[model samples]
Target: MKRRALLSSLAAGSVAALAGCNERGNATTGTTTHDDSTRTTTPTTSDAPTPPDTGLADATTAVFETRDRTISLLGGRRRLPSGLVMRAWLSATATADHPARVTATLTNDTEYETTLRLDEVPPFDTTPHASPGRDYDHTLYLAPTERHGFATTVPAVARAESGGWYLDGPPDRWQPEAVELAPGETLVGEFAVVPERPDSFPPGRYAFGYTDDPLTLSAWQSSQPGPTEESAFEDATPPAFAEQSPAWYHDATPETQAFLRPSAERVDAPAAVEFTLHNHRTEPLSGNVYDWTLYKQVEDDWYHIAPWAIPVPLTPLAPGDTHTWTFHAFSGPSVECENAVALGHLGGGRYAFHVNMSSESGPTHAALFDIDAPAVSVTPTEDVSVEREYRLVRASTPDDGGDRATLVVQRTDDADTRLLPEQVMRPRNRGLRNTLPFFEDGVQKVRLRTTDGVVDDALHGGEPERVFRYDGNAFAAWRA
Candidate 1:
């Protein structure tokens, strides 16, 4: 029989074996029946008849043994179809006033040994909310009667969607490593979650489970002793990027000096900041133009602002070559291009532009600049309520001919709103009579400035006008 078919049969048997087991309190035991004379007897709970002398019985035995060890490590009373036992409970350290620490345990209940291959450092990890792409890829070995546990501390709030279970934050791509669990031995791993508002968290009973299914056949196939070779079940590892010392570039026959700098020391928000890369080396400098990254400095830390897309091919810059790039200040839209790098907007602050030189670990060149607020300002005549959505309009006259303006909407309550650049808008007509949506539920302000600095008074000194305000149920126009 094919390996996949054999695994399917084993999985079915395991599920059948766990049908009547209780999930809450005590461990469940299952007995295996063997017939030596024919070597073809079927498991009591499985619907599929066991074929004679195909090693199905032996594989089933190994799976049962492996599950036994898993149960021992996890203290799991509940059985899973993947031939594993698991349990989740709140730790003693958790309290009503503090974040809850939830722990999940898995045990190996068998007298034999088994191994687990995982995609991450810890064999088991979960996200606070459901995520579709969670997967595993690291290796772990478990001896008979051994157990392993994973614990995470999350907010005390319960999730009705997950049946009152509190999960941890998103998974991190940590370096992978292997671990071993000996018989009757226990290993515990811990992870931390970012705490939510203190008032939002309340004490409650919650369960925990891995984001990815831990009982899949690929998780236990290596540990099963059967005709199938373990190597056949292994996944191919991705190739690692080449790394070189920084001095390698300097030591080259024709030394290359590549540096990035902004066109100006200070740029206005809603405007474009042009960056220039000058290659002052005897040899041609080759690198990917899309490898550039934009970083914003907050206090003492630099946070990376990811680009939407990156061009794939390498670009070669000859001696005395200069390349120019532009990023919209304050998160404005970019001019569309096939090879253009779509960058996020920048707010008023200190920023650095970095570009990779040769390889993944190659040295990077960076330039720094600052952004200042635009000249225009939006002042509200009355208090802006958070529950209402207002529309911004500019009162235009016949005398206002062929003039354009850019309106900037800023949220006063959130400083990080600058990271997202939807606040900038350029009205198309010269009169600037078009209305723009201001639907976000927050205390916000608007600034109106000329598309070009030449039209300074385009949107200012306008007459009283009527605009609509939405209050969840309906929209009402009020004259100001």
Candidate 2:
């Protein structure tokens, strides 16, 4: 019984880890940590971009902002920890149409100059000739240098990234290279990852997102041996990213109750924030990144400090039919400035969050209106009466997602609701596999909240939800 219980608990933890961004909290060992670079306060003569209304407002268009800080380009993953984004675009078919160029530039983001040696090497092996055929997983044409592989060291200053940040090539193409990023300068390089075998494969085929770090054996599943990230809880952490400088904190007392829905007793406060994106524009909405900014209310007009960001490469949000991009961020005073999850999207924008503390490089774009919408609350089921063997409540959604939509089930028999699972179910949209768990004998009020936003394009949508009741035996047949 004890063994089974422990295994069941760990299984649940692992599932929670896989759902959100790859945090050190995923595994019991791997811990990923980053340095906190939030500045105290810079003397600003002028550089603040005023918020503008772009007329793309939906009922979900609530304004939120947070504390601004500096983030490292590399040394970041679960998703790219380094901040340098690498995109892979291939020809439609396996037939080589575009020139294959495998190029890479190592920038020196330091004070001195640096050199980078880009080599095409296989993984290390106990025997001399056996390495190539073993260790590495994917098979493409490439050479090997050095006994093991290739190496380079580039010395440069801060903010210096190499230009043309890419590698272009046909098969037989892995070569290592490096560059120097000068002080306050960046060295970016790019080539083509065009495989020699193009149309021979197929059109609109598999090209990028092949692997997070396929170049090196990064994950244990892939035979890569790097330190994993640390855990969010402190027990089961990830490997590479561990407890670094910029540490985070949390709180659940009365101070933050004014914002988030307060629980009667102490409980976990994890927020499942999803982006309800509808690309109403002509172009296929996407870019090197899909940055989802979660704003906490800070000042009156300034909003709050930025604590959580849903950073991922979103797929091409086809023409119509809204797609929801989901992510989970734990909310407590320790990990945030306040208790609020306001999401925003930055697609095809010129400026990245490239702000420096000392005032050398600062300020970027001033978006007039939000391209994405705010998350709308779904209505609770209504009416309660006794019936047959099973008791239930219908799922309510602006889109009528029906019984399938996943919900964070909160069972409250107490008008003064107290202890219960902070987050019972993860909010997922797999098309109506959802069934609310009810245990009370009398009428029980059940609430179902949508994990993602509702883009009504119109502001006031009447409380953004419906309500229903759950009887002892079955749910009433009704629609909100």
Candidate 3:
């Protein structure tokens, strides 16, 4: 399937709510100010003043509370050179009698396609962004003066534990990664700032910012000091893919599958491509002037497929800039049988995927990548009663192992288990639980037997799809 076709569904579901902002109400005699960056509050006559409107009226100030609530610290939008619009706002919330909580949201306006970088940490990280984690490590407070040392002391916040393969080794060692957004795509990320501790938040103006803790700053600085002159995309010319690169291929081996099969789930569509984009020019470049088109090489001919484009705007790059681009054939695990039909994943051999780029001025292209596959032995299960093989692709368990595979459960008298090439099986991701509930409880070695009745395909009544029963289980027969 073409990249564009593969990502079309994502585009359809990317709408984000931009309301609930700029809500206004009376402060009940509390202080109200109109400063661009300052919040307004009026002292209530009663020590137990009535709660002000929870709906924040302005970008800055709101009623102070020991409980958790979202307070706007700042709000604004930036228009980039690529015609993409960027919106950012800071909000504060805290649990009851807990330390104040703060978060920044950076959104891509729904008007155009754009890309946003999410991999940077503070000081060097972009504004209107919150760090990732269960608890934020930095404290946010207003200071009597600016530059009280952007330095911060790392708090006693424990490092969060996680499962799965993280490309940058540890969470602290993460590198920058970018997301392509369809029009109106909104991403909200939260981090722990001024954790719920006694000294986490000191008396101050309490604007939307983290503490200048030295330890915290040091760790983030070492990890991501922002995109440096050497890191920005630098290419004064057209962008092209590198030569002889296998953009998409199966990285799993038999041993890895054996180790992962019992422990992790697999994804229906597991095709992945890793290739570098090289800028062949002498000047820095930005913007999406080139149109991307994907193709599959069948036999000797190159067939066209749609390309996946980020609905968001692109950032500028420096000359001679080259960066790796990882593309997944499917956005997530395929949950239905029809997804296979859409992907056209039958009869596989040396099929290769190529990404081609074109511009109104001219065509500049490269072979994005390709994959070679072994033939799948499509045959009936052993039992004479149940004819069709239940060769469903498994959704990947993203937590432990980072790859996907299809567990070929051969139901013949001498039941056999084999790990087939994932793509050969269609994306049937109707939640693995629905198809293989036993998978969650651990693999069940139940016997397969043919049932007496036959049924029509769910969609096409005339078509033949087989249904079988497990000798050990008492549920209705399953369709294959």
Candidate 4:
């Protein structure tokens, strides 16, 4: 369903599609002009029935945006230092017509991992990146205070990914990390710029950026901003263990099952993936590297990923207490896939996730069902006559609540009633409906039952019923 166009004409504007820009230097000055008469026109004349004003290509929006900014570096420095890349854009915006997109891309022009510094001259809050939300699988953090820190939060980016978490706190907060970046490889993210409008702010123009309209950076970048910056991050060094090689644990220590298996829907893997492992034993497990051998169930070949191998120093495990750790792996060529991850780890220990598939000699690692119970609900009736809206209600009684419960739906119909089916709901979701038609309504009896899976404290489910009244008239009229 879309609006149709009546006339055909080219919109006026430079038809030149903007090619992406590179790190500009003093070496290049004027706009490089292409040959004349060769410029192209968009929405060119077509014979196969013209397209509507809106198409998938034309529909876009801004999810992230910022106001504009401009700054004066200490010595009038226009270009950032080597191993650095910077992009300044104006305004935060959204809602199609006010579209904004972050196009800051990493330039692998450096030999090793590097950091893109973020510093504001004065008075305004500084943002070092234009696109940090492009990748949807992970979480993004902002530095609170210091402006200049190199490296990406992701470690493998080698100087590009800064992942260490730091709180600069209100007015000036930030986070930084280090990654091993390689040449010619680029990591990209995106954002949008937008303005703020609240019931309290009147019709006056509210500036979106610091000092200048769009964004600008100048001060201190020139002679290198004075060294007032000191990362809240204390030690820049990694733990001694992370520097050592990895060892594969392949012995039987009798891992006892604490609970039933997790639900199939909650289970992440059949084999290569185990939710998380706890240190049930008394001794501490220490290792510099962790190597995991994953396999594709269908392919029968080994898959590889850098599993998190960490160290637990001479710390003793108090009987009845435990420590937990998780491992994640992604896809590969013939049988490969990658997934996004969430969850943060406190640093001080060496943490790395590398993917390397190789042959191994050992007994297979297996999983036992520590299953979780299923959740459900039962309802009596979903529909009622317009006359009964005040009396009839959808009702359900869970197994546990049955003894402690009373009438869920008030007395209404006397002729016939159809009970509703139960459904499973995940975290944060609600109001899901079932489309099964009511079975010949009048008044019918429905009941609920359960088992250990239904009674577990960790599981959720219920059973409910309804009475159908021919004249009680207490339900909402079906909106045909």
Highest TM-score scorer: 1
lDDT tens digits by residue: candidate 4, 119-172 = 342111233322112322222222211111121221110010121111122211
The runs of at least 3 residues in candidate 3 whose Cα sits more than 4 Å from the true structure, single-residue gaps closed, are 1-129, 133-144, 147-285, 289-291, 297-303, 307-342, 346-480
lDDT of 1 at 102: 25
User: Higher TM-score: candidate 1 or 4?
Assistant: 1
User: How do the residues 207-306 of candidate 2 rate in per-residue lDDT, one tens digit apiece?
Assistant: 1122432332110111111113331232312111111111111111222111111111122234343333322221223322244332221112222123
Can you rank all candidates by TM-score, best first?
Answer: 1, 3, 2, 4
Tens digits of per-residue lDDT, candidate 3, 1-480, equal 242232222212211122212211211111122212211112122211112222322122212233222223322233444444433222322222222222223334557666554323232132222322223543342111011111122112221122110111112211124445555444333222332333333222222225331112101111221222221112212122334222121222221100001111122334544443433222223444233344444434444333323344443322223334344544333224431212333233323333232222323323323333333322322222222224422322222233332222223333222222232132222221223333223343222322212112111133232222223332222333
Quote the positional error of residue 68 for candidate 4 in Å: 16
The estimated TM-scores of all candidates read 0.26, 0.22, 0.23, 0.18
**Cα-lDDT of candidate 1:** 0.33
- At residue 470, candidate 1 shows an lDDT of 20
Worst ten-residue run, lDDT, model 4? 3-12
Instruction: For residue 61, give model 1's deviation from the true position in Å.
Output: 70
Prediction 1 TM-score vs. true? 0.26
How does candidate 3 score on lDDT? 0.27
Clashes within 3 Å, all models in order: 25, 140, 51, 93
Q: After superposition, how far is residue 183 of candidate 1 from its true place, in Å?
A: 81
lDDT of 1 by residue, 1-480 (tens): 243345444433422333233222212112222222111111122321222121111111111121211010111134444334344322212112212222334444444443432332122432322111231122121101101122222112322221222222223322122223333332332222112221222211112234342221111121321212122112322121123123211122222344554556567665566666654432345677777766666565555555434777866544333467766654444455443444323456766666665423345555566677532222221222222335443322222355454444332222221221212222221212222234334424333333332222222234232122222212222122
